[model samples]
Target: MTRLCFLKCLLDSHAPINLPHNVEILVGRSKITKIKDQSCSRQQLSLKANCDDCIVEVKQIGINPSGLDGFSLKQNCLYKVGHESRIEILLNNYIHLIEFQPPPDNFSPIKRNKRKIEDEEITVKKKKCNKTPDKDSVLSIKEAMEDVWESIDEGELYIYTSKGVKSSKKIAAFDMDGTLIKTKSGKVHPVDTNDWQLAFPVVPTKLKEQLENGYKVVILSNQAPIGKGRVRIEDFKKKIENLVAKINIPIQVYIATGKGFYRKPTPGMWQTLIEKKNDGLSVDMDSCFYCGDAAGRVANWAPGKKKDHSMADKLLAENLRLTFYTPEQFFLGHSIANVPMAKPEFIPTEVKTEPFNDNLISDDKEILVLVGYPGSGKSFLAKQIEKKSSYKYVTVCRDTLGSWQKCAAEATRLLQQGKSVIVDSTNPDIESRSRWTSLAKDMKVVCRCAKMATTKAHAQHNNKFRELMRINHLPVNDIVFNTYKNKYKEPTTNEGFKDVIEVKFNPSFDDEKSERLYKMYLLEK
Candidate 1:
């Protein structure tokens, strides 16, 4: 029997594959293994074994470069592989040692054992042959890299294509990690490459129904671990491919790989689908829908259930103005109801009509020192006070000056010129506030502290909102907020301030659109 073996094809070694002499046996991504490597072509190589010579002629037809015994084959050319050789695919991305395991006892070609050959061939044929994927798949994963996927926004967003996914007027979008599949390891995050299974038994049937009903299936996922260095990019990508292959249906995938515009609760990916990936077809908003596990349900909303991870998915659907549902509601027969999440304490619409300051407005020259968390709206309030002619002041912001010393220098200059200065920085403690208060004494102006009424939770909510909105500011990390909270001391008249003003948080939106988003839940918990 003219037999060959692929050694080291997988973590678990593959068995020898028996070949029919003189017949061109097809070897490809689908034929080789269930795990599809996009770098490896579907029709990667063709092999014809010579029973007499114990050699195989391999034709390099695929776009990916192939190595035969360390010799690179010319495009569309044939290279003769000896009894024992090594083939490197895609520059050693995968290496397989090929061995010629001829019939036992060095039997001659003419006297090949028919029964043994038949048995071995049957086993290898079963291993090698699987039904090819549907031809209607939309993706072109043949070449090493093709138009099947595109990474934009500096790899923050990654959009993928499949063989048969057709853009229709309607979209049936779903989240992947929790809604479609869960880690078989029973962990919140996947333990490794193999740690996954369909989230529920009915997911496939429900999704297939969507496909049959002319709706495009899409996986809109947030895989921040790729950028966070928690998971290898290649491994996660292979997992995605495996999930798609298991579904066995054409669908598109949108991955937000970072904490940026494409992340959920932001309309970046949805807008991209409409503006770019939709094949020039306008989407029917009324027919479109989204389903996810992060539906903002509170803890114990169901038996043994924890609080939903975040309201981001529900907020995403809200921003898109599409029908939203939990995976249970969409796939299982769970009743659809309003997704309940505790609204953030501060929404622009609910801002109180109370004055920003507890005291009356004055044109008196004074040093206005603000104290709070990093995103406590102090700088914004300072700018607002600067805009008023009666409260005109040169804002001495530490953020712009880059240091407290620079802020002191600028404030000294402003005060020397008889201009009142509003120092906008997180003066969280007595020590932090004393510097500005001391400066006020040096300037011989009455110092007043405006301790913002916004709580730490409210500031965190605002920080997340700004991140989702892509506002012109760097994201405030938890360390910054925690540092302020840890050091916070209540501002009082005892800190040498003439007045300790409690500034109520009365949010004002730039437009109706901003106001609408602010009303949506921003905090995950």
Candidate 2:
């Protein structure tokens, strides 16, 4: 009679069956059936197992099933069966139909002497599975960045180059795209890997030198394209990896895919790195410096050159209370160049804080018109009046409603309910402002225009700041700003405004971040 020892536990589904000798075990969807010695003589079994349906792995060998072939459980002497510690192959799949009777109460696992040839074969397989992964096999960027930063939010994924480098005193933060790399196509935006080229050959040498000088080199970049589905996350990760390899230096990278606190100029990414990732070490703000290309300077106009995109990088440094450097100044040791702007002007009392009710009719419904450039603080002023003043008017802007006609329709509907309305928009030209004046005439209310004293330069600066910092909001680019400027006709008395109050472009936000942002929005050279 064949001496068979049944498994101690009755497997409701699939469970490990500790066998006594070298045996071929056949596993079906439900149960493990020991193949007879006669059946093993003929090669008959072949099937592919997808992980989604069935996942198999031998825990002792550290081998996870890859849904391929030539892998199966066998009673081999490599890890002796019932050596008190039996070879455990972890079954990570649903199983069914296992019928067996209990063994004798005194039953004990059988152990046999280890075999030489079979054990050597199993050892080779284990070594192949446990070896260090090569570069190409590394799937995600985070896998390589294992230790640098502890995840506070999995939604905001970040990558690091070397082992986590913690330093309290010094850090060198740089921006990625234009500052470090540019398109090979000689275009502003990248098309593919072929389009990428190093911005400066000195970048790697400089960064490596910084790393050796007791400074933690980090890349803080805004990668909104990743959030918008314009760029694949995996491809972006690979791009970062390629850059790091090319630079041949250990660096940590933080990419802000969407605009939020962590995005540049907000200082959230820096704050996280310092408080969470620095391993209780402190950052010396005085010794740290940030570098980027968006200094908002005028176009270089030279061959194969472009204007600074925005002043966001400088503003980001300002917000962090750290020393700031342009890419030219930091990497090339060049002096700061003259930043160009279109007719720069500044008025200290740009924003008027006086009572807006004084400009309002006491008991009559009024149609308040806001007239300014695209980013002239017009919306801010209108909202301020509606909140502080007793007017409590319903304010609407064309940007929010999609069009001027839509805004007028919404305002008309609200006015019919005996509510005062404020039309907040960059009513730059007479034709644009006429819609409001006409609406007021139809509503039979007094029309008042709050003309903001914000210059074109100030508006453009503000536009750049908003475009870089805001999420889900459409960017108000030079094309849109210039479109408005082309038809701008300075608000006039003939526009039918009962009273035109000169509203200064002052905005007071509650926090330092907002205060810093306000300064950046108005900053011009």
Candidate 3:
């Protein structure tokens, strides 16, 4: 008989079965007796209840006439029996013996064991490697001397030889602000990640490795914000702490703030670090490395030019024999090729003489012509002259005119007033200067060129300083230095000028001398 039919009969007879317990009722000769073991029966009942709740209907149950053995049910029915005899009876009813498995074992212990092995291997490998010099292992001044080495154009090998003991250790220093953290677009909003953090993934990782290898990892940065009152000292400290944490390295950080000599491109910061390290201590300056992202900083301390050995790098390399590295070399892991070579420009020795022509200036009208290379103190000098002199200063550039006609009109008005007019413009070439000179002739004013002959080096230096102060992007490299040096046309005897006052800037005097020669020009009657 099917279990469903037997259940239906039991239900019709009004026989009550415990909902918590599975009832095994013997349905023979129209008598029903229920057997129950409360605990086990309850569990079995729960399982069967859950199975019944699933979306499946019991189809058929068939018994094998020849003795209850393995049998099969149609669908959705599960065989449940407490004894072997009952199981045999279920088999006789053609119920399938579906196998049930116990719950799976947790695999955490196996995974943990594998991880332990890997960790042990790593530790063992580290142990086999060379021991990092202890923090107390102060290098002798002589030993330090062995660390300085030179790089060749086509790559070179550095051999550190001291007392027949040779070991190579490379240290690389980095600048923080403009080189690493770009503050140009303004302060990194407290939320936005720094671009350097995004670009150099290997810096932090490699820094940690270098630290572990007993290499001195240091940062020599110049922060002028404290003096400018833009950022508080504590806030700057916190920002640096945050940067260090992200890098996961214990880097010795030195900040030159508040107009101290330690600012970058000045060698003060590097000097401070070296002096501090070398104070009455047997420390080798040779193996130490100094690096910065600023080209000016690198160029300032670079051997030659100032021929100044007062630079910390020079003291270390020449005196202590230490090597230096730039960020370009460190991050790239190779010497940089195609660095801008300082090609000696052809600076004219002779100044073009200005013509002594009556047309150069009109009666009782004075003309002040401002002339200089880009950022060569021209604007500042002009401003100073405007403040001191009674001359009315006029800037003639994109601000006043879209065309030359407008410029001429404004010049005409200033000239007609018989006022001492100053034109603040970059009259780099003779053509541009001639246009203004022609306007002066038409106005019948006395024309004089106040050349702001600041050297290319000085102009570039001022520009870099300004960018740092303003936290602005570095300006594009002006090819004017090369252009003017090579193809610049000087004002000569042919071009009319009442007087040419040469502004001598000593940093590079060749340009001044070249401009001064123009004063001797005399106009034809």
Candidate 4:
């Protein structure tokens, strides 16, 4: 979180300040420190350092100027390092100066690089923990700061191990937030330590039992909010430490800060752990099981519990071919029924083809309008028409185009060259469909509406599956899908569509990954 503005000026000449005026320079201390801006003003350059042992003074450059050497500034003027500053220093061999410019009047204050006191505070705690601790049991301050040896993904993923017997083949993995513990305030995510409480009174007992049963407990959780740069990494670290202390057992923890193969249901973390951290012991996949809260289930809230957030945990188990259980099932000994979702229409493979027949339109010049929800496979179907059909149609999707109007313009140009165009967008309303039909009519070509036979539940399921799978596609959230649903108006022949064909959901994926994603679309809400 630290945003350091390093101002370094090498002694190239004796008179450095004589070079340029209005020269911008960064001023940073040799040692890391936090300077809280109390005024909260873009124009105000006043700053206060949190360290009581440090003092700011204008001195000779060679005296370390406290790491401010290159700044082109004036003497005896109040200044701030990151926001605004101007300083001048004299040295025996060269003159060093540094200047920090204030932001523009309209600039946002939120853009300021904010740093938390967590690192400094944590370093102090680590120093205390390092003293007189066992070399193998407790990590040295340097080792604790190092990245996990098994992690290949981006972002800072800290690994902490407890002092306990290691297991080569058996590992019991559990999720953190909702599975092991929850906020005492009943909030989804807690802002502070005091807000948390154990998910159940028996959590510690259950973990101890697992340890006694020769299972090395490991925590695999997704903490995506950390990647947003708001939540301090030290906060997450402190939480993990507190959880381990509460459990009072040897365990390992891994938190995926963002979406990636390491995130749940991808098996990247699992693969990395068993391959690199297991000390050459082969993992018994049959005996090892994963527990998480996102097992697809009917809602547990209010009159009818809302459906579980997702089926990511269950799917992760499926991907790994391991046993899967909900927190309630594993901890509370409850049998939560697996909620049925839409069945996937077809199996997906490494190479995906259009799941349904898309040759309904002839190779003759025509304007084909597509209508569906965000995750209703409109884009997939459109790509199929271009890939599998004889038309070799020019497909235009709103996702890639700047606007639908731009899509129409492209279609107009392509059709002028005697090319058939497929408008592969969610043409939800009659007015939207008319934009294409009007173009086709003006060109004396037939317009057809290929309404996808996809339901709301199916679309939502598909969207969630896409997100969970981390597919290389634009993410479609509930808001985006809902907005399309609200604006949808069934197309009619009167709207200029010469024919309307209901394209069935018959996607075929050549790979298991693609097939799993398609099944998500088929899952009944």
Candidate 5:
């Protein structure tokens, strides 16, 4: 028999049992008999037995079930029974009795410990599910850069770094056209001589601040009109000198016209100053800063119009300690009273390529091959094509390697996706171009090549500017230029290009060949 102990609470009414431990318990009704003493009638009755017997505990008693605490046993009340426990119930008038059984001696301890471990593991997993990356916390580039220059203030000690030297001095550089003066219908209106005299005083104030701060302010600009013979070099020089004298910013000025190294966005102008200082001059490039409105060439030509200095700015900030500030930001410290107000010219429209009205080319896939000598304006043209045409510009150097198998795999992927892709690379050899043509054929895609065949002299002249823009050395020797000139195979009718267009360097577009090239290459497919 199982040993058990039973306890009962006597009151005016019978009550159910409520036990703390999980035990198999049963309850029944019983009658309350009057005892000799009132205190004895209210006392709990207990029974003790051996191991085989069951035990029960009464919680409370009252006249109304709602008045009792534990013995109310309302709806939704739950009872749990432990292992090796049994319960019994007995019914009587206005009295309740309950019984519980004891567990057998052979219960397994190891299984109970394993069950506890499993329960703890489940609890830990539930906690981990609550932590994750918030959906709304992601940021875009423009918003992330909103407060980029908020900390900069006037009179702050600005340090400029160039060629590994750092200097704490204010170096002010100004862009001429829209910054210093306004140009109306191709004619530059002098600020002091014009009605906008008050607007021109900002230059003098900026210059005065620089002088007070012991700064070396300079003008590094590109005067392309001189190269085009629209403006004489002497006349341009006079205008610059007159403006500087009027502003009272006694500063050195470097202007690059036509094809020169010292130009903004290109480090040549800054590099030239640094070299001059190394020769015992007083100029300091380390304490110099470059401010410009446009990225590269001044003209709004197709290839020259795109911005190129974002990557260059990143490089300059890392290597030269030179900070590039936009005009919108530079005006934060200075007053806008002297700043020239000019609206940006909107001329060039996006090119559009129309598909054949009929189904001459039924396959939706197409391959666009961009061919040119290094710095022959290939990337710029490719970008224009990508923007204007329906061709997806795919970078082969970073995406696909020189290996034939890898190239084939990537081409197949693009073709399957139904995207017309433009491959921008130096495809100087027939074998390289042939691989792209073969991929197009295998994938049933239409293939075309837009060759940039600018003259070697033109490419070389542009190469100098490109080198300046890169502020680095040419990867190959002069042999690369010679090879590009001599070894270039003009795309012929047999070269597998469904359509082949050639581009040349022509600042003036009066020639029929130049006009045709522009229409064919720049217009669209």
Candidate 6:
């Protein structure tokens, strides 16, 4: 049987302390990290967790200090710690997060090898006398980073490069998040700025080798949190500096904080480098290479690993016309796997062979109900219908009109005036489609269902593209997609429609740049 972690203490720069349910475990200074800080006690806090309920029975035992989520802990009293509790030991600002995790299988873990944890922590190094925090470290880092960072594209993109980092023709570009480092706590996202470690032990060695080979080692990464305000720019700057400092190599870095040209697969960052920052020298795409983890590999691409987050990294190399390598293939010398890649649903480059059929409406007295995903270009198609029909059909959208009842009323009002009506909305279910079809039946006009054949992948691509390109685009979450998929019933003549017209997703862009971006991989590979 697998031993499940009932309650686990996640410490920075330390091995996770896995505690079984109902069993008490002590957490403190050297037990977590070797950092000798006098503000922490040898036994700071004692915790007993119940994984099923996701609650911890914790007690402060040490006088040095221990607090839950910045709240004062009363000594000698048991506190019911919630799943979100963070136990701080005041140990040089290092936080010890205590989380309760339920067992994966049916059987709840009754006990664990508690003795092993104690044995492991016992081999700690000798502690120093009353060690204090280093204020100079912050000052030194700020000094080193002064005048090194600059932003463009209205702060969507940030470039951080020191004068010491020399430019070269043979580039060694890499993705930072999964390629060079990963969250130390093994969480999908870093809990704090300090919560990252090298992805592989030999990361530094590999980077050093790149520099030795006369390649300009450059790090390019998309950090959306920076733009979303989840992560402060100053904090991320410190993280980048810390990472480069650890490697102790002359390396430049580009960070795409927001979605746009600078974001990978667009080649904007690479273009900017060659155009502005490459010391008036052109880069050699033939010899240069890029490395990232998002190679469009599926789940179990590696043993016990999930699929890659996106195809941005691999697509970036393709856009730059450079050779690409997964971090595994580059650092570990692993051969490339023959996994099938996820391709874009539409080819924007393919010239429009056949003219678009504008005869969507059979008559002026008609109701055309559109049904598809939100980003499936429902509104765009509705506008085209209104134009092709020469203003004969008035578009009724739930998004603008506020409710389906209002949409039906407006459609009824338009139909009564002898004008055609186009219902533009994600009418995913039969009930939603029935609203318009039922109205058409009462009015004695033909009700046709125009079904958009846009896949989930394609819809997501269009959604992302709009979000990045349009300034006033509303955000569409995955929950919306899930809701549509769960309730969607394919529209047929069974729903009282005169005809179900199948509409293929053919994108109409305002410019060539947009046309190119739409052709690229935007979905998570």
Question: Estimated TM-score per prediction?
Answer: 0.66, 0.56, 0.35, 0.63, 0.32, 0.67
Q: Candidate 3 residues 1-97, lDDT tens each?
A: 1122122111123352212123333221122323232211211211121122211112223221111122222222443321111121221221121
Candidate that would win on lDDT: 6
Query: Which tens-of-lDDT digit does each residue in 156-228 have in candidate 4?
Result: 2445555443745888998887889889886666867556778989999998998888787888877766654
Q: What is residue 281's positional error in candidate 1, in angstroms?
A: 2.5
Off by over 4 Å in 4: 1-152, 156-158, 296-311, 332-359, 387-392, 454-473, 505-525
Per-residue accuracy of model 2 over 345-367 as CA lDDT, tens digit each: 43322434444545543357888
Give per-candidate clash totals: 9, 4, 25, 28, 16, 0
RMSD of each candidate relative to the true structure:
21.1, 21.0, 34.8, 14.3, 34.6, 17.2
Q: 132, model 1: CA deviation in Å?
A: 26
* Residue 137 accuracy (lDDT) in model 2: 23
Candidate closer to the true structure by lDDT (higher is better), 3 or 6: 6
Candidate 6 segments whose C-alpha is farther than 4 A from its true place: 1-147, 153-155, 186-188, 338-354
State candidate 4's TM-score. Answer: 0.63
Error of 2 at 147 (Å): 6.7
lDDT of each: 0.69, 0.58, 0.40, 0.59, 0.42, 0.71
The lowest-lDDT stretch of 10 consecutive residues in candidate 6 is: 114-123
Write down the TM-score for model 5: 0.32
lDDT of 6 at 373: 94
lDDT of 1 by residue, 161-227 (tens): 6666677778999998789999999988888878999998888788889999988888899887664
lDDT at 314 for candidate 5? 25
Please give the distance, in angstroms, between residue 403's alpha carbon in candidate 5 and its true position after superposition. 30
Q: Model 2, poorest ten-residue lDDT window?
A: 117-126
lDDT, candidate 5, 1-525, per-residue tens: 533433233222333244334353333233433323332223223222233423222222221121111112212223322332222121111332233334435544232210110010111111232323232111111111111110001101011111111122355666555455554343344322222222244667765676668765656555554433345444554565456557754555555552323333344445544543233344544666655444322333233343322222322222335665544346445343443333212111122233322221224458777677776666556555555544454434312254445656776776677667667666776777898888888777788877775655445544553332332323223567777667667776477878776654333234564333222211000
Superposing every Cα of model 2 onto the true structure, what RMSD results?
21.0
lDDT at residue 360 of model 4 (Cα atoms): 58
